[model samples]
Target: METYDALLASITPGSGETRTIFDPATGGVVGEAPVHTVADLETAVTAAVAAQPAWAALGHDARSAALFKAADAVERSAEELAQLLSREQGKPLNGPNARFEVGACAAWLRAAAGTPLDPEVIVDDGETYAELHYRPIGVVGAIGPWNWPMMITIWQIAPALWMGNAAVVKPSEYTPLGVLALVKVINEELPEGLLSVVSGGREVGARLAEHPAVGKLMFTGSTTTGKAIIRSSADTVKRLTLELGGNDAGIVLPDADPKTIAEGLFWGAFINTGQTCAALKRLYVHDDIYDAVCEELTTVANNMPMGNGLDENNVLGPLQNKAQYDIVANLVDAAKASGARVLLGGNPDPGQPGYFYPTTLIADIDNNNPLVAEEQFGPALPIIRYSTIDQAIEYANALDVGLGASVWSPNLTAAREVAARIEAGTVWINKHGAVDPRVPFGGAKQSGYGLEFGVEGLKHLGVPQVING
Candidate 1:
């Protein structure tokens, strides 16, 4: 393995003012990140705005070629990137964690490169010729989340750069290293400041949202922060793509097989320790198979081991920060106090060094409980029973936040029928939060406006310029 000091390159050695990052797995000091000032963010945004014209003027083919090379660069350094992600992000190195996230960087980069979104020749056959062109928006400010730090940052910046705009990133303070490293890898092949990183907390993010030079804002975080971003952008009325919080629901049909669905159910809720904006938080299962589903889900939860992310055998890891750890622990404790059945792994061992919460399953919980009503962005799943499909649908659609939802049933038609009724941006028939780079994802209700991924994602990143003659 490369020395730990090598990952430090991601953070440029700034002045005396620096922030120490802690390793989520061991709670040890990992490295220092520059406590970026508003001046630093302003500098980055100004540089991006200045750098954008040349990048956009390079034309699609040339820009794509450069991004393709960046993708190659990411693939070449996948190991180092994965290691850095595991150290700071507190996700397992293997499985759908750090390595998987690094691999996805390459995939998303390539997909962005290969996207064929040429100018559309609208009304070409008529007397007047008109063409609609997706033109580059100036500087795009990307404020990313911590859960899937590297991947989420890529999801914003890659498409923004590929669409012929310059991108400035401000990753979550908790998991900044991986994204910084990823950006460093890509910036090697690109023009200076076309892609930039400014590391700080909310103040930095708010500055980006309010920056006049930043024509677009693409953010992924909580719904509360998303509203703030919207408010901050009101000054500039900047275009935005916000993928906010999700209290996603999953409804299992009566005929579904518990054994067959258990693994998916486990991952749907537990992946990234349920920190995902789209991870299924509450499950509404038909009364006929509710007990069986609970049993199988409990078995899945028990079988999986949680530990340091660096361990290859472990699939689950610690909560990336203390605040989130407390949220999970307190919610689980409250659920236990409320007389809900703790099916598996509720008691957290505080004696342990890291912020480790067990894979908890709370059964027979009321819908109004915090674990059910709120977005429990941690490794806890609450299973609720409903007597009919109508009741399940009611429970699923009741929440104000709807980023994603799922319907599990053997009958594809029935699953699709129910999925249509759920008010979410992305509804999966048999899976929850199964995102593809080619499929668009957003939110409904208060989950936030705009979408990410696919052709629509690229189109929205830029302003539509029409030539009428």
Candidate 2:
């Protein structure tokens, strides 16, 4: 196992213009991320274009073997990567945060490697035969978000590589070092230039999206940025898979036991300090159990330790960047101003050095309250009360962005019925934001197009071609 410093050193540029990465937990220096430019992006793209053909020629079995090795490589440096991720991304090492994200990287890589995608026989008659096959789209450009940076980057690149395409990653500016380190570890088992990270700014990302050589672009970030990427990739007509913003909702059915479901609801909303796109943000509790659910949720939230990611006991950490922190603070403040009851943690210490917004749970907030209406994307959740299931579903689906949602109820039958009506990619019964590598996940109605994960996700990474006779 490598030390954290060793892992950080591996990705650090020996000589170049660099950006100082600060630890969000302590405002301390994490490491220097190389400020790569558009020129660097062009060079990386050229290298990927040159490398893709031989990679494709290696065939699926060979590529899968390489990915499996890459997964092993990621495991070898897992501790180092986790520690570095904790420092750079401000996610706790112990929880489903830093270490979990690193583990997810390996899991996703292995899943992409092992998932079978044999050519499908569409039709076969005596007079005619037809089969459907997926071909590599050459070089794929991946632009990842700060939240779950390393894992989501793997989500984009793993399938691309599994399908015999090279990848060029552009990590979010807020958390580049973690991605750089992750890509470095994975590259150890793969051929040179097969996968690379361009730690650059918006300009480099813009170039990557628009570059003619990039046949596909996978982006996981804000809807605004997703749209910009769409426009940029339009001229090149690049195949794209975009997982954008999500203000995911969770409905607590009247039948749900508030005491029993409290922990699940807390973690679903507060995981990674609520930075996840699919993490439950707006929660609608049946009026019959509104007060009970709020009390239970607050009790659960109050117990979870929040502080520096390096601390073993602290499962919650600071926001990855100040901008996100401000967004959360402002939205919560706006909600408070709207006369919403602050069940717990509406106030944060002004003297706190880090962007440590306390785990906030706002109750009696209107569905239209800014905190409920907007994607706060932090350690805050708005609990809204609904008198009817129809009202809850209406509130949940009011927003155009629907990535994931959940209905908490013991009645799986009723839960499934509610799940179908909720406009989102995936809905969990009695849980929320529980993503599986084998299950397909994507957004609906402007939450961004294209599917990810499972065989469908693998298909997204390739271009389908039908052989007809």
Candidate 3:
């Protein structure tokens, strides 16, 4: 039970830059975190590169076993981990919270055990044969975001190691402690640099991405940052998997029930205080049920309790950090100035410390509004009524982002048809953001490049080597 202050004493990185971790609930300083230096990043990369070959040589079974052991370690530390995750990340305890994260981490390890890699075969007459096999791409750099920091970090590390590559993770500056804590528990089961956690801000992350020894980079964050990583990674021609920002649209067709639609709308938009990248930022409802749907959704959203994550009855928690709080606040203000009608909560409570903006719902907005087109990345969702299904699809597809979209219609036939039409990497029919480990998760267009969390994910960590024999 070492405090963050005690832990900071041993760790080096952000040497000169004195930063403090906050208890978001109380607006209290939780502990000090070093803003890592560029040289520290180089040391981490060098360790990962030097340690990776031996780890890769341990072969698949050993690697998979180690991952499972790490998963078990995570499970054993569930209570402590969940509390720490809540204290650091501000996610409510009611939702799957840290328990869900640990389960997913373990499930990923199990799924990776079953995922098989293959060597591509070429036609051979008699003596000559040719095949292409998968080989570890050396060291990988994983950059994780503040929202779901531990879960996404596990997502990045699990598949890379399963494919025989070592990973060096840079957790977001806002929620670095969760990853560091999780890593401390699991690192024993892994080889020295098979998995490592480094803390800091942009400088540390940039160094990791551009490092010559790092063979690939996997990132989950804003589209703006992803673009920078894409440019920086080009120097080494490293393999990249980016799960970037999403201004996802949830389409509520006329065929959908107002009551059911209200439920989906609530979870899709307000889950994680609407901090999820794929959370519904814009809602395109058929004009027929627009009024009724909006009313019901407003009722559901406004009634939910918001407070500290440790409060058992609280349904929502503060935004993870101040910058995100400002982003949510500014978006609400802009939508209002642009004449978008605020149908529900749109303001942060003055008394609330941390980033606690209300579960806001805006109406009478078209794609022209920033809330409709831009990634709000918070608890505010704007509803745009559409006269026709085509109009809804058109608006949903209009954005440069294509991360996730959901079609809410009870009719399977129509929902499937509409889901196919939406230009997003993931389309949930009658559900939103219900992710599974077996599925490939990523995005299309500016949302991001490459995939993670499934069979396809493991392939991304390795390079295809073709040999003729």
Candidate 4:
């Protein structure tokens, strides 16, 4: 909290209620962050709305310059911010942990800065000329999630600013301080109110979703909240970019080498302790190689170290908070009770102080099992057996939430074929949840709408106006 003293001192005190931050590793108090009300959101939005036009008037290059400087600032404070992120979010300090997230943030900001919005000429002739112009929507209300608080906040806000929209961010209450500190660092490079942070819980997020002045609401969280935002934005018909929940399924084909794909499979599902939205949740392996794949994946998962984020050797940390920990615990317990074979970890350790659960693997589970059916969003993974490719694909696409999926096979052509059939916005051939700033990302079905990242994502933050003469 000492790192963020200046920023913390500036925020107006909360209205009676206060949200406390905790270190998931020790279950110790980190600090109490301000619990902003709807009135606070209103003020933030008003200021953002007032500031957006001038910021946009500076043009893309000027905005890009500011973004670049912000990236530099992030890079300079990478270690500090990453430490705060790890303590609050429970992702390890090393590996693809907070440091990696912070670095990716700088990279994303740079990419978003360089990313150009090219106008298209619909009709070009001597008689007439028509073109589609992308104009920035006013203020964007950015709601970030706790899973990758710092990086995802950058993912949500940087593009909005690049597209010339001023952002009023309401970061996840569980991990608000990291984002608040980030915004403090960033707002130094930006104009006052151009990028603002309003910290709170569900009420604050709901208010941002419905706030009349918020021209666009970009969210990174659950599908349930995304649906609510869609409904709330109805009156304003605000532009929305919702990166919602994903219970992504990965299929291991019979032709695939289990030993070779094991490492990829383990990290694909267990990254961020399986808290990732796009992490492979339920995995389907061909009946022939099911045993080999499970054995190999179990070996990899078991070997990975799980402990406090501050420990340099620890690769996996605790669940971000108690609520998510309970959710994961309940699902794994239900799976065990339903007769699913626990090839590895099946439940939380009762003696553990932090929200720690082992890197668990459950085998012989069917879609009927809670662990397989629901988004566990923790360290538990269920391995389901499929008789054939058709059966695997059928079960994988059965879910309403389709954010990302993966097909693992040595044969690229076969993998591509399987990948194409998977019902998801993004599909990986041999990899999973490997996202790039240059490509568009979002969801299909109930996962929500509007693409984020890349040229398509930049356009998503803008309103299309066709100029005809």
Best by lDDT: 2
Clashing pairs in 2: none
lDDT of 1 at 412: 98
Error of 3 at 337 (Å): 2.9
Model 1 C-alpha lDDT versus the unseen true structure: 0.89
lDDT scores of the candidates, listed in order? 0.89, 0.93, 0.83, 0.88
Candidates sorted on TM-score, descending:
2, 1, 4, 3
Query: Taking the tens digit of each residue's C-alpha lDDT, what string does model 2 give over 130-224?
Result: 99999999999999999999899989999999999999999999999989988888888888988899999999999999999999999999999
lDDT of 2: 0.93
Q: Tens digits of per-residue lDDT for model 3 on 1-469?
A: 3453443344434447756788777687656666777787888888888888898899888888888888887777666677777777888777756556656766776777667777778758798899978899988899999888888888888888888888898989888777787888778688786677778779889888888889889999998999999889888988899999998989998988998778778888888888898888888998899999989998898788888888988878888888888888887899999999999888667976777888888999867887787788888889998998888899999988999999998899999999999999999987788887778888998999898767678788889788998
Worst 10 residues of 4 by lDDT: 1-10
User: Number of clashing pairs, model 4?
Assistant: 0
Candidate 4 TM-score, C-alpha based: 0.96
TM-score of each: 0.98, 0.99, 0.93, 0.96
Off by over 4 Å in 3: 1-18, 120-130
User: Which model is ahead, 3 or 4, in terms of TM-score?
Assistant: 4
* RMSD per model, one decimal: 1.4, 0.8, 2.5, 1.9
Clashing pairs in 4: none
Model 1 Cα lDDT, one tens digit per residue, 121-170: 88876788999999899899999999999999989988899899999999
Residue 300 lDDT in candidate 1: 82
